[model samples]
Target chain A: MTLSTMRFTEAHEWLRPDEEDPTVVTVGITSHAAEQLGDVVFVELPEPPATVAKDDEVAVIESVKAASEILAPVDGEVLEVNEALADNPGQASEDPMGEGWFFTMKIADPDALAALMTEAAYKAHIGE
Target chain B: MAADLDAARATPLTGMLAELGGKMVSYADHALPVQFAGVMAEHTHTRTAASLFDVSHMGQVTVRGPGAAEALEALIPANLIGLAEGRQRYGLLTNSAGGIEDDLMAARLGPDHFVLVVNGACRDADFALLKAGLPGLEVSMAEDRALIALQGPKAEAALSALWPEAAEMRFMDVREAVVDGISVLVARAGYTGEDGYEISVSAQDATRLAKLLLAQQDVLPAGLGARDSLRLEAGLPLMGNDMGPDVSPAQAGLGWGIPKIRRTGGARAGGFPGADAILAEFENGAARSRVGLRPVGRAPMRAGIVLFADQEGGTPVGEIQSGGFGPTVGGPIAMGRVDAARAQPGTTLYGEMRGKRLPVEVVPLPFTPAQYKR
Candidate 1:
């Protein structure tokens, strides 16, 4: 896997810098998020052009026992979505970082990225 | 799974895994004691993809003799002789008084070769009854084999990738195939009302095979908690909860398994227990019927809850047998035995739970419509 230094949110969301799409950053749930959610039977992702601010609930991940929301790390509009989860949500457990990416968002405050935890910092935060 | 073997053997450190990280809970007299994820997550994964269950607690037995089919036919209402080779029939075993002893799956591998799968807890008594009922037959125990169910919509496709030979068999069909070079009998059947296969393999090979299936992206490890809710959601009846020695087969809504041809006194006719009373009830409608009920309130109702009529001073007409919050339906659903007059679909009834009489409606059995392959 290519190393792309992404800032991780404490709630398990990750934001990586996008050179080709500089204005928007790729967003996905971390491995911890998938493990905690158990077997993901269904995932409802946010639609493009949908507005979401920092800490706002933007998507839902449903397991057999309960449904949980995936919050936004930075305030912005959803630019694209990973629709592959519509038919195969278990990908969240298999290839969580790649195929399981939930959506991408246009960063509202680029400076907010600096405040997020680095990979090593996240490992320590989750006590991994 | 090795730890489970230790517990099954009654080792002292029974709850060792629970203290570490596994979620412990009590089920069917033994402690489930270990769920790495949560029950809900394991349950959810089984429905969408594949789930591994430890069903070794279930009873496994084999009956072989020249009169094996005849002996089995004397027990279950299904025509066992007509059951072709490598085929299975789902039917009930009744008592002399026309009460259902238990519901079981009988598989005929070859002439004079039959395998019987019974409920986990009821295995001992069921085996005794089978032996006592068929005195002349040669019944042996297949205790060395472990029974595992790989269930879900993706089960067939996933297993087909590994055991290509099992893909051709349809619902209720049985055949043998080699899974990872170990010979196993793969049947296209399951209790969760989903498309899947149940394979009988040697006890030592079970854990290894389960790990192999778990390694596949589509498969996940599930436990009994998910198995119960899934079967409930599918509206399948549990042997003890839905029917017992006190309940008749007609009242349990399993009359279809009793055919008219068998009742006409053909070969091996009238030798089984409960034939007279069960046939009498078959000719005449039962006074009470098992029906499904959905409570109007949020509070969950469980077995032994009394069912009351909808009148101003409604009288108790029935009682709930098994109830729970249906994971798929997002509400409480249950099965109950009620007066035949009040068992009609859409009949309003009240269930007494924790001193409160909750409004319950009498619907058909199986709160959710079944999605069996047949």
Candidate 2:
């Protein structure tokens, strides 16, 4: 879909700038990460209002096979979390880039968005 | 994930697996499928239907000679002498220090004849030890065969369609049978704690038989991920993870496998490798013990999580050995060691994870009840 408008991180997290709010971005793992994780059984999202530094372990998701950490892509404050993940974590795998968004964040610098990988660049980075 | 097959060993079904959407992972130096469909789906399918698993990576050894039974009994803890032909028993190979070397399934094929299925990781060491221990017996690796397991509630119905006698077989029964003219060693036993059969057939026929089983109604191909989760949920202690060369059998809740005849005061007592320390522990008790762990919340606690008696103080009392999400339990489940004094079921213990002490409960093993066709 509109994945061309989103940015991706090496950790497989994707970020989409909020259409209504340029300072805010919606974040979730990419479809690639979700596929690699098999079946998602549990997801622990960061608490809202929490300030995280770049690369900080801000969330955790447990698949039936293993537990993996979802790190912060940039310094930001957690604006809101996806509470729907608690009841049906499989959504993370079923619709990773859309309804499966983990949280919404307000980053310290909107200019940092330029540092993320464009979808086409990410495809090559993952050897697609 | 794709495994680097350059230096990895491949099972008879390895190539077929790669073509069947099986995700590969390198384990025990072998390039094996870690998951085919997905862990949760395969796991739930096995509980409700039938799932086929390629377990050929495990070592298959056959021992023969008039004294084979007695020789093996002296090396492991089990009443092998009393084990009837066409039956199998779970056994533990203990070191002289009373720690478990490995756990295995021993089947009495005939008088003085036995077949052993051992852990893949410990196959070489187990073979070497058995060879050295049973000096005069015919201990040889049956590498020509491939091991595949069909597990689940519908396993009987699925297998019976091919081998009509399968419906008559009970739990732990091992017998020779013909499946559409392909002779196989069928054992009504599996790690999933479900009614199922583990079939050992010639390596050349492995893929053919697996495909046949998968073609059966409700039978899907599962991989190592579901295998591990199913076994953990069944309260089975994995050799390297939950029980190992450092964990005593008694401490691992495996004392029941050692028959009374092998104990301190029995007909053939105190003869095994660690008989002294083992019997002593039977009389006394292990300082620490294995217990099923249930992480407090939805967050899954994992291996290497340090255990503390208090939420935020003192030295670590224990550590989690095997931890993962149990799909059957519908939550995260784990197995770990804790101080013996506080190892009772329902006791609360704290595990340190990510700079925070998380609470977990000590519970009885086998988070789910076994559904064996006994």
- State iRMS for model 1: 7.1
Q: Report the error of model 1 at residue A96, Å.
A: 27
Tens-digit per-residue lDDT, B206-257, candidate 1: 7667667767778866666578778877777788888888788888877776
Runs with alpha carbons beyond 4 Å of true place in candidate 2:
B1-4
Best by TM-score: 2
Q: Could you estimate the TM-score for every candidate?
A: 0.70, 0.97
Which pairs clash in model 2?
A: none
Give DockQ per model, in order. 0.06, 0.85
Second chain alone, TM-score for each candidate = 0.90, 0.98
Residue-level lDDT of model 2, residues A49-91, one tens digit each, is 9999889999999887778999999888999999999999989
List where candidate 1 sits over 4 angstroms from the true fold: A1-128, B1-36, B264-270
Query: Which digits, one per residue and each the tens of the lDDT, describe model 2 over residues B1-374?
Result: 24466577888888888899888777776778889889888999999999998898889999999988899999988999999999999999999988899999999999999999999999999999999999989999977788999999999999999888999999999999989888899999999988899999998888888888888999998899999899989998898888888788878888888988988888988788888998898889888888999998887888899988888789988889889899889888899888898799988889887788989999998898999988
